[model samples]
Target: MTSKPEKVRWGILGPGNIAKAFAGGVAHSRTGTLVAVGARNPGKAGLTEAFPGARILDGYEALLGDPDVDAIYISTPHPSHAEWAIKAAEAGKHVLCEKPLGLTAFEADAMIHAARKAGTFLGEAFMYRLHPQTARLVELIRAGAIGEIKMIKSSFGFAMPGFMPEHRLYAKDLAGGGILDVGGYPVSMARLIAGAAAGKPFAEPDEVVGAAHLGQSGVDEWASALLHFPGGIVAEVSCSISLAQDNVLRILGNKGRIEVADFWYAGGQQGGTGEIRIIRPGDTEVVEVKEDGWLYAFEVDAAGEAILGGKQEFAWPGMGWADSLGNLRVLDKWRAAIGLEYDIEKPAKRVNTISGRKLRAGGTAIPKRSIPGLPRPASCLALGFEDFRTFSSGAILLDAYFEAGGNLFDTAFVYGSGYTETLLGQWLKNRGVREQSVVIGKGAHSPLCYPDVIGKQLTQSLERLQTDHIDVYFMHRDNPDVPVDEFVDAMDREVKAGRIRGPFGGSNWTMERMDEAIAYAERTGKQKPGALSNNFSLAEMLEPIWAGCVTSSSDEWKAWLTARQMPNFAWSSQGRGFFTDRAGRDRRDNEELVRVWYSDKNFGRRDRAIELAKRLGKSPIHVALAYVLAQPFPSVPLIGPRSLDELEDSLQALDISLSPDDLAWLDSGSDQARARA
Candidate 1:
């Protein structure tokens, strides 16, 4: 905290009608003052009349650069919220963006990340959430006035007289829709009420389902969604621009129910009285909230106080970071269920990262090395994001990787049952970085592990990836029953046909099987298997991690890999939490870890790793990863980092230079560099 200011100087960006309401609210705030109004054309914007005595800055960027502006109130179109909010944070200005902080949860997450990175306050402009009326409602719910809430129903809607295709509410390119506009009022309230009933700040719905009437302009004119929360509470929410709704909120419980008419306009904009009625079998109660301040004034003050307090976000009851993220996620799920996606979220429109940065090369944290079969050099770590469900969520990490000089991605047909492949494909296509990327595609795992299925699955994987060829392909698993010729012959045809441009190998094939396949390929003049993906780490696997999984950590297997100079795209390169102190001989809670990695020898190796990590001034996990990277052969470790922090943590291994002696000591507390002299 630098110093608490008497008032937060505010600048309003995109001085439209909403800005008028917010600007009026600023006049009523105790913690804020109007500094400037930012617009594209300062001369014709008429800021003199709309916001008299306020400086008019030409262009949004000008406001961001203004040293006098302490905070920015972004009232831009829905699609530009993420852009302006991030830019403001980067420019060292606090951001209080208009509600529905972003069109999607991904955008909200990015905005929050930027705020956190910059140490600036960021808030969603949900005025009702900060109003005293909302506080009283929450207080009543928590006090059990409604007697164990079970259900909530709310609506916000109004009719547009005629079809106005070019209107902001109907324009597809502008991200015009009822759900993104007003649907959040009920959803946010429902979550808040549910949280109050549960005695928490907020609660997210377990499931969100919706139905929308898509107008001719391809925007949701009216929509209704159901949010199912934990403990059997349900919320029914609706919003419309082409039709009028009651615009009321109702909470139902076992003993009684509460109703608030026009809940969204609580305190009535320019300040008046708002009523909440509680009804029971034979008794009735009414709670009236009175305030003399404008509605948006509460939000402005809330943000100002948070910034002045050196906090990065508003406290509960206000739309905090997590609350805003949860609300946007609910909105995303609702839109997905109703198949209401705007053009901007599509691949064609998302040509850059949400940060709006185009990926550039050569500022690498993870170094690149050549793989025999890949057309491009593979990063020391092949990113495995097999759990991603959406493009926006996954692309953030992908963009970070690409910008950090990572060129390799690992995916399989079996992962997410092919959704992972599609997501990877969408990310690559949207980012337009396929030419510089090394894609590791895998197929034919388990129940369908056959030579013929390899080609078929490869075709499907290619289509899902939106690519004509795979850089380095692999059969996800090998079938011992099938002849080596069948597998060798099948993949050879793919390579010859230009479908597999790099080396095609097996993910979990045994050493003997791999050697036999190599011999068969050489004898038949076919493309030879050039890589093996097995579990390799400081502590070797004692048993199969998966049904057909293999470990190349044994002495003979390592010797063969070293002699052949074949690359091992090792998965679980860091022993899958073996070096993390949480895993030990006493702790057998993880059955897979116990079943596959537990042994007296492995425990000694783990201890030696901790000791060596101390000497190297790094963590045991970093030492474990470095051991894999510093292997004698062309070994590329595949790291599956689930978040940006984890990705950065994995990159720490690249900096640790592990010599052969260090590797030998990490593998075992051996006096000799090799297992035996």
Candidate 2:
């Protein structure tokens, strides 16, 4: 028994190039039908004249009111993509909004909210994602065809100087620009290939630094950026609106590389033309594919199946609204870095949804007032963390932090066994905000820092972070065996490759070694480390607390910092919760940490912290955190808060101010200090 293919009647808004393609696509598809076309003016009504069987309405509202239309395909200029889509969704029409999903994630959020409220299906028209070829590519990568994809290089752009101003590609009012116009293709492709390592598309580029060739209208006609994905997969993505390129997409892995030709959405142009070339260490083969007729048809079918099944959006794992938002977030950052702003999005549209459910950037108020060892006034949002678990709290906290006003983030690869780096990668997605954020990445720790670990770990860290480069990368641990020159050379290579953004630094290294590293970079004509992340605290440690622990809390260290212009992001700025009493002195209970950095001196410091905690009418943790924030240097403490309550509790210390005398009294002769005396 053969079941009849279900038909989804579509109402297309805006009679443009995309609309015609979609109309022609329905004519060629088996699962959907185009029933109506809407135009803003009668003069432009000719845009849909080819669809003789379908009615052409004078306005979008007329088309939405048509009972026969089950859905609306939004092919309007970029600026109107969200508005009309939300209207259609509110009218209970399934919506397939065109790519660059919306002018911003904020706009996209509105449309999504409306769809959810109206109980309608709303999907971003990322036609390429629905193509059979893209599906196969995902399968190959997931199957490890390219063992552990470590890097991806892709580009899509073309020159168009002779184009008309009314063309959406050149109109600022249309939200036109290379990044949002064509950048979406390569950026989205990068997200597809990076997979779970990135956790989401638009892996919050740990850092997005780039140069652009701007057009007469101030739109980026050509721009280049590097996206670092988790586990060391770097996607060097570029795009140009004014010139043409191969539009090649390549995913580089440890074992091989996967290259796709003309990887964007191509429907009915060439029925069966492109090939995906797989090149291995020793073998090379080109796999060909036939377009499954119309590319948009697949999404139409997916939309139909989803709506019929009572889902608000397509449930495809990677193509969900979350993924769409991620892509937009990255695009948002790329545009921001290049100074590209669309006038149309100046005052973001109001939420039409019942929740008045607009997307608001969360986490307000700087956490610096409460954090310690910070050298400068805290930015709106500063991402604070230790080691790799980069994405999890660091990334999640950063998102919340940024929504609140944070702009700085810190990370090191060895912390989460790379999981942290991976997490950071996920946090950086389609927000059109990169320049405003601060990223600190570290390399060379554990099973890795034997000199041989430098290059691979840094590259891997970049990929995990999901940006082309690291804003600030550090040497996680000093390897005495590796000549300082060797370390400098490796980092120098990345600097040249444009993999590490300006302002590099060191972590867990002594001041002497840091001086040696800075000298080596200078002598070699390479970039010098600009920041330092060390065990700096309000309380001092006399002797080694752990087997390999290092601290730069000495007065000499402060003098050195004052002399050097380098910035510092303090680690364990809160003294490992020893000051908070959240961590008890009984090592038997917390063996893991006790074995790492616990000591009798730290316990004594903990006792004094408790006393001070009482005097301040604050928690020991808050006093400890306040102590770190009291430093005169430009420093920020890396706090580890597991819940919002803890985060809020930590945040409460922001208003607590300590005097220089208070600092002196707390540290002058605490038990740890007396022992040293």
Candidate 3:
């Protein structure tokens, strides 16, 4: 690990109260430094009134677009976080967006995806979780100091009746509400505590019930929610702006209980000064842990390290985009239960027309299975590992899939820095399964799209695969401006050079483009693309993955594939897990993922999938995979499983056989019914 600096360069977005205090905290930190201030009005930045020598920028765009700005700290309103953070990530800047990363989980996923694509860092700025004292509390709780946690109670509120309702804190248009503003703190803490009890980084509540006192501004003035964990751990949390609260957190277990005072904004007005106490059964004595100084500095350090070290997201517990999304999903429900609906949650503002797809909260790892009837491949290699360099898990997943009669390994040069290919190479070497297996490789992914990249990436991939040529190759994207002849000639050259053999496919390309390419190839006497790799789940895309790129799943595209006898390696065959409602909402960074993977139509499909899963005695995820595998044409679904459990669940589609009537029924639901109202 690289040693943390005595001071990290920091840029602040928006000049709000949180930003002010955060800047102050950074000024006092021995390991952080405030470098720039980005506000809508340059004159209003007033950095001289806070931290001297901190330059003020004219706008948020300038802060992000500036090459000198190493990392950005977004303290803007919730709605703006998603827009600005995405722009920042695209500009190659690391981001630390405020709590509740975006209004929804899909938004957070988009932000994460953007950061991943950019090779930058991103994290929800939940300063309190990073306090040294929070870690100590978790350590004690994990050590059984609190003994099997069973219940939790926490609250954060303050009465300010005389305050104007237009302030950002009370403005519904700004996503103001007790749940998002204050409830998030306690809820995050509960998840952290619950996850620690189960030896995981996080926990999804099984159920959430909410009630709130609404302010005239239409936001939650006071709100309370109940969270049920799988292992009998139930937690109650409350927050309010119209009433004073204890701002305390307490957890009860079989053998003991733990409590924290002022849990959300733990540190005192100036910085860290919060306290936690543990009370064991039959012991009146209390053991307390004290935290010192402003906690936001830790978030700054995390973003700094990620940017300088090239990490996709922060490693802190209870502070990832996923955590933020989970917390918001619960909060959205709690607010709804309380009749505290922000303008943002209104039907007009949501991308999906439906109200909200109900989720099965709670950490229930139900076994997921794939439906049967996929075209017989040489073998089904599990092309699912995320980190290909890590031999233990990656190779283990491959072996597990191969041992189960799967012999075709799918990979891309862009995956894991060609680490996936390297791992596959080493696995082949170790098992001597090279000739027995078929290799599928893809290239030209984001950030690596040079035409020359095809040959260069292919050569490196072959070297890593320990093979002279690939059995199947794919153009991961289509450059609309790069004429058909150019692409065909390049692939044909590779085929003739013995670098790639047999068939080639197209991913993220449209039918017109594919048709043109094949036409060009046929006229020129070169091999045309023999496969299509686009998203072909039960739910199709409403828009292109990116702004300009279109998916090759339209009728025309499908017809082209069918006409030419081209098989499809359907990317996201399981609708990217949306059929199970596993695909979350948007976030501040990875917006593209949210738009492409988790739209309203997809959510609607997932809602129906869940109902069908329950009716069929199968997991919703399995239903989704089955839907993908049920396609009429010759299709091979690409699955990204992180563990044996996920791999097994994704494989459930192998057995399910959805009739044409069943598929049509699913696709033709009240189109409006799919709208998350």
Per-residue CA lDDT of model 2 for 1-677, tens digit only, reads 94433778888888877787777767776667888888777456355467767888889889989988888888888867766887788777988877866776656765676687688888877777777777777777777787887888889888786755777777777677688888878887877777634444335455555667777766777898877755666778899887888887878888888887778754334355557789998899877777756666666677767766667776654367888877877887777677777655332322122122332443456743322322333462245545322122233334445655666676677766677666555555434455555667777774467556767877788777667777667787777776777777777778788777656666777888889988888887877666677777766555455544578778788778868845677777776655644467554566544654466655655666677677667787787777677766666677765433455567767867866666655555444433432
lDDT of 1 by residue, 1-677 (tens): 76667999999999999999999989989999998999998998467899877899989999999999999999989989988898999999999999879888878877887898899999999989999999999999988997999999999999999789979999988889799999998899999999999999999999888999999999999999999999999999999999999887999999899999998888688999999999998998999999888999999888888988999998878988889989998999898898877888777777777767676777577778877766677788899998677776677778778788898999999999899899989988877778988999998899999999999999999999999999988899999999988999999999989999999899998989999999988887888999888888888898887798899999888899999999999998888888896698799898888887889998988888787778768898998888888999998888887656577778888888877777777666778753431
lDDT of each: 0.88, 0.68, 0.70
lDDT of 3 by residue, 1-677 (tens): 95744445778898788888778767766556778888787785355687577888888878877756777888888877766777788887777888878665545655665676677778887877876777877887789986789998888788886657778878988888667877888888888889998988879898999887776787777888899989989999888877898877888988877777776666664564556677776665455544555566666666665656656677765387667768877876675577554676442343221112111112122222221212224432236555433443355456556655666678888788778888788777756667766678889775565577799888888888888988888888778767867888888899899877668857777777788888999998998877777767676776765544455555566666556656677766665545543455534244645666666666666667877777777877777677655656666677777545566666666666677666655655654533421
Tell how far residue 644 is off in model 3, in angstroms. Answer: 24
Clashes of each: 1, 62, 50
TM-score of each: 0.91, 0.52, 0.54
Give the clashing pairs for model 1.
373-503
RMSD of each: 3.4, 15.8, 21.2
How well does model 2 score by local distance difference test? 0.68
